[model samples]
Target: MALTSKDFKYVSYLWDDAKAASLQGDEVALLLYRSNLLGADLRLTNYGGGNTSCKTTEKDPLTGTDVRVMYIKGSGGDLGTLKRNGLAGLYLDRLHALKKIYRGLEHEDEMVALFNHCIYDLDSKAPSIDTPLHAFLPFNHVDHLHPDAAIAIAASKDGKQINEALFEGQIGWVDWQRPGFDLGLKLQACLEESPGIKGILLGGHGLFTWGDTAYESYVNTLEVIEKYSAYLHENFGKKKPVFGGVKMQSLAPEKRKEQAAALAPVLRGFCSSYTRMVGHFTDDERVLEFINSKEVARLAKMGTSCPDHFLRTKICPLVLDLSPDAALNDSQALKEKLQPAFDGYREYYRQYYEDHKHPNSPGMRDPNPVIILYPGVGMFAFAKNKQTARVAAEFYTNAINVMKGAEAVSEYVSLPLQEAFDIEYWLLEEAKLQRMPKPKPLSGKVALVTGSGGGIGKAVAEKLAGEGACVVVTDINDERLKETAEEFTKAFSRDGFITAHLDVTRGDTIESCLKEAILAFGGVDIIVNNAGLSISKTLENTTLKDWDLLQDVLVKGQFLVSRAAVTVIKKQGLDGDIVNIVSKNALVSGPNNVGYGAAKAAQLHMSRLMAAELGGDHIRVNVVNPDAVIQGSNIWAGGWAEGRAKAYGISVEELPAYYAKRTLLHETILPEDIANAVFVFTGGLLSKSTGNVLNVDGGVAAAFVR
Candidate 1:
């Protein structure tokens, strides 16, 4: 618990100077800087967690009058990368006045309207519920964060006493109260009573610190947290707590990954009927150690350490069963094993709500579990999209850390059940939910892309992710695969992109890639078989080695990967799509390229057979045959470009234009053009079409079927 302090780097170097100069708003810039510094540290605030504010005066454009404004982090803004517009400017006077008449309000439903009404600028985003807290404080800057070190103390039974002792009687304490108008007023009262207080700790909630400037406020926050951390470190001194006497049972590490891979698709398929859930598996030693502990079943059932997690992660997570027999079974068999467990979970959730909820309470949320504890396989989080699933996973991981700290000091304690329910159904959070954007077309779908190291495969994977599909990128070259995954991580989250090293020709390797894909993203809804190699040699001159290599990759690779992927798609019981990228030579032979031509022809025929067979499973299979897509395509790389140019009797530089002139449209096809056709077929845009070959070679009449 020794305070873990990060070396703070001045972030002005990270900002774009020209962009900053164009928008020269001092308060906005300062707020952004402060938010980034504080939010960058996960120990201080998580991705979208925590709120910050600054009280400033801005001259009204129309009135030429200076007005006091409170700029709080707008709802749904991630503090780690906050921008100027991420803050909502509301008139302080108007927000403060609402508190005066808040006591007479019968219900909190009007909170959203009241907050919206106080917005001075019509274009400003909606302010957070904690705007009142920021306004109630007299300081120019205020920060409210659920820092782990602070929350560990705040969630303890002796939280107040701990705070008083750690802060030398300068900190104020308010009993656990749901955040809103009432809690804001109570915090104001506490500060007034202890006029010399530096900050206040809301029992069982989080920490609040204020200062005259953003820097001062940020420093005060760190100091308070350091004090809490030191208090635990000095007393606990690396002492581990033994919470239970019973022996723990768990699968070995290798078995855990093996089992998780087999079971993830089954669970994902079962949950699909009610919610589109993507699953992420983590076997970080800490997670495995804790999840496998005998005490986990009892302690995990209590509740989350804080209310912030309740909305994203329900109060309690579902603990799934892991039988050895179930792991080796197919998705259908696994489903049979999970159906009873899911039924019991639903029944328990219903009874728990009936026992705690009032008659007029809001209806129950989706009873599906957010975090699933796979006893032997570690942990899995299921959510509508990858980002959310990762968020839940991170939150649960944090919860384990916090609960361990609390238990080490003493038995863990949770906030009252009624308060937990109140926060879970808060009007402001509900408004935020309503404001959430609609899901994308392929939101819940998982896509597996082969040859995604670059070129057509990479383009297809990127487009699929943009359309909201969780993409699993696979390539033979491990370095290229890693680079592609890094790029995908920058675009979406790491959860949205999973990478696998696969030699498509290797049967065992193909099987492993499919399992890893299912383990990472639940099940595959889209498959892009773009991995192949070329051999420019005549049938008589082609060596046996060259012919076997070409056939192994071009023909056998597609067959093997599709064979495994089709199993997952069928087990998921969802309509799926497969797009095979073949060569135009498949329809029209290329001179002296016998090995590649024959293999591609074989693939085209195999695709038709797969379509005929898998159509019964509602899986659409189609093929895209392109003549010369040399721009950003690796198929023509490795001296093949030179060979193709020699065959066309043109220089390498003139090959593209030569091919372009060959097509009726006189246009050279790009990798993205091929990707677009793949998207149209796989995205269900052409649901009625299957077993079709799309010639993406700029209108090649010679390659056209009709």
Candidate 2:
């Protein structure tokens, strides 16, 4: 059949007949294709929120005969990026046979372990908890999606009645039941009772649709969601004002962002009280509309209705009590109110865990809210990493859409507190958490590396990111910045780091770069002042311009960047590190290096001074001195190598060997070597030590710290 050739008001129709036809014979491939298409659209399903399955005939290794196999999305895998290996293939017969031994709802979790025996492929990924939901359904192809429009209908107070009326009984309605063996049975019973029903609306949950063919299943899922979206929009339009109308106007775009940036580090600090958390901020129109609305407090308290929504966002978001305008106008007052707000959220969350948690439940996870809503400013979502934080924000945004749609048509209804608690602390969910890999040492840290477009700065950024810190790679060279960003994207994925063009000598640029870092990953926790240029000349040859330029780039640049970042660091109230990349010349005092050496000496002393002053704030300031980081060094590229070679009476090629020979260890220092020294100072290895200098010059006695 021709794919739905029509315009969709909410979601895009991306089904291509040619693409579907290409995978016609491969049932699993078709399922993956369908899943990808659906998952690509946020309006259809959220990240890692839904699952799809297709039954295929595969040869059995034991019997050497054909057997029916169900391939479904694996646990914790996202459909949009699903690959062939990400699908778990289970023997359909074995899955069906396990039902005979199913004791009841109480023992449903046991069935999850038993699923291992049903694996069709030994190399298959772990099956999702929703496996039974797909296995028990009689259709050859099935799709279980958490589409916002469908979820809005399902989360409505009269969800069952609305489902019956909206689809004219074509789609059956099942009251709220946490997904597991029992819910699967309920789906089977619903279908058994009404074999003509096309889909099912799971109350306070999502929608389930199926078909005889993969394409048909894909189309059916879209059609159901589209109908609901159109219906909801029509009703939403009819209402004079949504979400009880806006309670207050949004701060202007710039002001809103400014407010968000100011609040992010403080909020992040609160969220990270127990364990460090990375934060993501959003000022999207939908978020602004919900938070600025009259019913925001009540609806936020009610929490999210969709299981997928709350799973990432927590039971509910903590709404900031302060007004946006007030937050923007008075920074000090905003900070005062924020502390109490966070304290209250923690107490409430602690009580929630105590009130509902079973003795066997995994000890309460972090008591901090994953999501925080600021009226007129925006929303902040915190998680252990940047991507997770960003995804959590996206999920909450989806929740907002779901709430809006539900409120427009019928009063929105969240899951009962008990039900919500059970799902949040589910043993199976706890097991999934246990399965996650241990976080890297620098996981929640954010670093801003100036001059990171190349050389020591790039190496330091890369090293920090490898250890799990989100990095902001800033440099004045636009071309190199782009290259570094692209390279980092390949190495660490897009979320690992952000690139900003920053001329460190310029105060405005320094402020802009710090603001970018704050907005990108909440705030900077580690500062690498590596941006610099060198001028090697005797006192006579070194003109006033030469002396001034060296000082501006080396000394003043570090001062501006550090001063700006300290403002953010103080707001976070977290221990911070500033690693200034000074040089051996600062201590050695060689000929023709007067201008460069003076600047390096100034930078070294400045770091010591900052360490003494900022010690009260727990912000450590240190220095990394490198003799000659010639390889991949932009400083060396700009005639410094030639000048140094001339001074040493050798060619530029001999500089590395000469420097290495001079060191007691006879080792040539690379940019990565400098990067490692910086990490040692900032990576909690020397947490108690501050105002110290680490020389990465392979043991230059003259450069050794006294």
Candidate 3:
């Protein structure tokens, strides 16, 4: 069956109910992981554009009371697939208290933060900015969305006119107001004014409808949007203008030439695919009727329904009248003509702010017109995204609809620029920016680690990631590096760990990998030069090839990556850090380890010089020398024990005791210990110290570094 207007209404309402359903079950989250309705609603609207909430009763552990509380969805969650914990449970009383702050204070931003604080640090997730709206509603579940049809109706001059046509006397109408407490307050008033009001339309805004069930709500939403959409289809689209068919009175040739120069540069960027488009505008029969009609044309109201619409549609359209054979003129002349219009827009903003925001606090973006609708120039809506332009398009369509309504005498007026400012700068709004979680201190910070697949590298990445740093994990093999990225995506954090194939010895690859890490994680904060190779050979017979192999990986790779990281660090004005994974070879002489010993020694010494030179920028440099470690391990594995046994002329089984017995203090060195050391040195604990080598060899190499 073809879906009717009623079906669409019910479906739209179902979205809100579905939002409630999502947070109630873990299964729902799995079902709609990325396409949550809550996300759709918010992203579709402007500024925390939507709201979400859920109902659950948890037993209070302290009082043993079955407190009826809600795990309301927080401000940042996408509703498409919310898990149970995505809902932050607010003590009904705490939310009620936060509500008082909104009523008593003049700031809406503050109120939002107060609501956020009540939610974020709680054992639950952060409460959404829409929490209060959900609280005021009379349902176990509630959600709000900006259905495109409804926004079109709400933002147009005929909002009240559209409301009259559809619901007539059945639903209530509200004047324009900023979202949040004011909306909630007016919504409450509408509920009282028309107890039977099934829904409401806020003039120059959108609609709100509720239902007892998801199906009921979804259906209502769809029906409402369809109803308005049909109204528009019938009223405004009867005869969209065709350039050649219309009288060419609006597109005088001279104005058409100016129009071409004004709009080409702006349209060029988004329309790379569109080879050409001619610009034309006339009073749609509706505009002409509007101009003649007392409601639209009276008082020389020759403008679009809303002054804000000018930002979307441009102040006016440039009528194109020139012949196809005409060549375009210089853009500079066009810019000069448009410059005054831009300044006029600035003055409007200045006046708007001056009138509305006393002791102004809210920062306004560029006030220049968002579009250039040159009559002969192609129509373009200025916006950062396709979505906003779509909004602009709807605004234009709505304007066409409302102009018909304006055939009657009275016209719609919105809150003045100053009242809008007071609303925009309201305490609750400003306060929302306050007490934001002390930025996790790791934002935009980056760290790179070698040999990060399974053990120490993994630990370090997770730890730093938990603190909010972006981590890049590298390994010689593609499989290992990608596996690390995948595992971290699941077990650690998504978008936290990146992988690269880096052998380290290849200078070109090292440089390229460093660039890749920056592009992935912003820039490097710490470099854990933890990859190395070791072999046991007597100095007398250690082949030049074997010697170079150890030196290449240990010294060359470690040095190159460290140097690359330092250059970026200095460029960023950061006090960078380098942690070299030196070994027990630097501390002690093991019998069959001539090649490994000489290589590690050079790497170790290079670290000391790095510390001395990089110290001026507060760049920390350190070495973690571990030996007698089991190599290829879950714990410091990878040729570690093999090297020790080969040096001592003993089997691997006996080397553990040999090292422990020789140490000043007998302590088993876990990889966690090395990871912790890396943490300690890179972060605050060791900030005052650098160029220090820490022996991580279970004290076996104490004599060497000491």
Candidate 4:
């Protein structure tokens, strides 16, 4: 893609005049706009890999004097979604003084304190480590990024030579250096050597582009990247890069998903050392093709594509075999297969840390791997939180892109082990790690909910997601399922939920949906059999079709889903939970509802049988019986509420109040009430209470346990 002047004008244009006027009053708004435009383009930067800054004038907090300020992206903020708060403003003169005297600050901690003290506003966030680099540069606007195409050229064996040939006198070059006060000095030195350079490429690091305006800096970065991409295409014939020579037989999408599901929990257990982690799997074409190469393990273990990526993905990925036979292995056998690999990786990391650490350096980081490569199945990114795991995954994905692009031209090279260590354990990043939030109770667990399009099922799935569990949602209704999945993801602020079109009555559909759930979250730790249908009719008036419909879905559907889940949990060897959403009608019969009542009774009995059979395997099965839940429920839709009202000789609109008044507490139940009951049972809060029935019917005497 070529850079154009039109792109600059578009960033300058604002949708709302008042809002644009407000932004124009503050220079940081233009910095944010250009930063977001650049960050939004995946080719430019990803995750938290980039920072942007602008030099402007703001009133001093202590005095009314108009002081020059430098607004830079703060540490740990994603540039694509950056807001005003994400920018850290510092008094320009103070930063300039620090640039001159920073050499006297021997410790990284001292430099951090100096940056904090120079804050233009006492309440502003801490500036990024690259703040000094932005301060020392003479340009009004600066943008620094580890763009894939730019990094590809920067990490090549002949990268410096290639850079010199491409831009000649207009671009400067700086070799790899630890990003702190010293790096700022090196950048200033490089600029003095080659004056008027439009951009600079940092060997083994990333790219820096700056100009008088944010638009000029943004376009220059794009122009440089576009040239590198064109060079790769010129030599590599525009083909998607992959690992060379290794190959795997392609399986149908359904089969591939099933295999990925079976492999997720095993990898999760094998990779974790102290705390459990969530796993996200990907089989994008490039990832598959690259891992399929014979050199996949060797190249993947070489080093990270960008030096800063070492903090997110570690020095290298943990490579595994997830071929068909490997995926089918039992827990004991799987552990045996993975133990040596884990041991080797840990030993390698320890030795690297020991060889590189200077006196007073931070202790060695956890030896566990963040990225995992499985040739046939693709890659897995593991983290304590789903969002962080995804960030790790995306960076690795970009790593492959750069490495492949570099290899197409020449050998793909990475920084030495010692350099990776310095970047990974930098004090600034260590501080951010200390500020991480406490993990949720179900942080690393995954759940599958059937009929999640509406009612109790949707409520249950959303509740689990809110509690930090990755949820797999399914429903026969496509539109409702999509809406539910969107709501779940937005509420949780993570991409940990997946939706599938599933009809519980069909074995094939049930099987495929289970695979989708497994691929999404690695494995299923909990399964809620909440899909249901009811036929309200007297036994004499009930037709065979109505009976079969209720029986097939209510009874047989739960059996199919439970059986499949048990097979996976047994392979995982982790304790699991299964909750069946039965009805209050199962405990007390209702007039003209023989089919619905009988089907629910059968399902309840089946839960008991499952509990008894799976007890030895540490898998618990429980039942939740709920009644008269009308709010946010689809069960009462399709005229069932009217039919029940007719039977009770009351208006349909009044039925909810009638049921509420009949309850012991005189309160109407909502779908969330049933969701809470299901959560209590599945969360191991009732760990020893298997083969038990919990009621969420607002205290019905007939439904109360004897």
Instruction: Note each model's CA RMSD in angstroms.
Output: 4.4, 1.4, 12.8, 3.7
Per-candidate TM-scores read 0.88, 0.98, 0.61, 0.90
On TM-score, the stronger of 1 and 2 is 2
Instruction: Give the Cα error of residue 334 in candidate 4, in Å.
Output: 4.7
Model 1 C-alpha lDDT per residue in residues 1-706, reported as the tens digit of each score: 1323443231111333465455455766677777887888777766788899988898877788998888889878888888877788898888888866675435555665799878876767667777787789998889898777777777777777877877888888988777777778888999999989989988767889988866677677777776776666565525654434224556676787788777777677666667668877787766665676677788778878677766677887878756533445556666777889778777777776777886666788777777888765678888898788778887777677567657656557876677777677665666577778988878988988899889889998998888889998999989888888778878987667789988998889888888888777777889999997787765687899999998999888999889988887877777889999998999886677888888999999999999998888889999999778776677677767777777677799988888899889999888888888888897757877889999898877778887
> What order do you get sorting by lDDT, best first?
2, 4, 1, 3
lDDT digits (tens) for residues 617-703 of candidate 4: 889999999888888777677767877898898999899999999899898898888888878987656778789999888889988
Give the C-alpha miss distance for residue 526 in model 2, angstroms.
0.3
Give the per-residue lDDT digits (tens) of candidate 2, residues 1-706.
Answer: 3456457777878888898889878998898899899889988899998999999899999999999999999998898888898999999999999889999988989999988999988888999999998999989999999998998988998788888998899999888999888899899999898889989989988889999998788888888888999899889847757999879999899988888787788888888888888888899999999999999999999998888888899989998887676634344666677778778888888898999999898898898999988888899899999999999999999899989998998899998888999999999999898989999889999999989999888999999999999999999999999898789988996789999989988998887787788888988899999989988887899999999999899998999989989888888878999999998988987888999999999999999999999999999999998888888887777878889999999999888899899889999888888888888987777989999988888898877778
Ranked by TM-score from best down, the candidates are 2, 4, 1, 3
lDDT of 4 at 395: 86
Runs of candidate 4 with Cα error greater than 4 angstroms are 1-26, 100-106, 237-258, 321-335, 350-366, 489-494, 646-649, 683-689
The positional error of residue 19 in candidate 2, measured at the CA in angstroms, is 3.0
| Superposition TM-score, candidate 1 onto the true structure | 0.88
Clashes of 1: 0
Better of 2 and 3 by TM-score: 2
Best by TM-score: 2
- How many clashing pairs in candidate 4? 4
- The residue ranges of model 1 lying beyond 4 angstroms of the native Cα positions read 1-28, 60-66, 103-105, 120-123, 165-168, 233-242, 249-252, 323-331, 351-364, 415-418, 478-493, 515-519, 570-573, 638-658, 661-666, 686-689
lDDT for residue 230 in candidate 1, whole number 0-100:
62
- Clashes found in each candidate (C-alpha, N, C closer than 3 A): 0, 0, 68, 4
State each model's CA lDDT, in order.
Answer: 0.78, 0.89, 0.56, 0.80
True-structure RMSD for candidate 2: 1.4
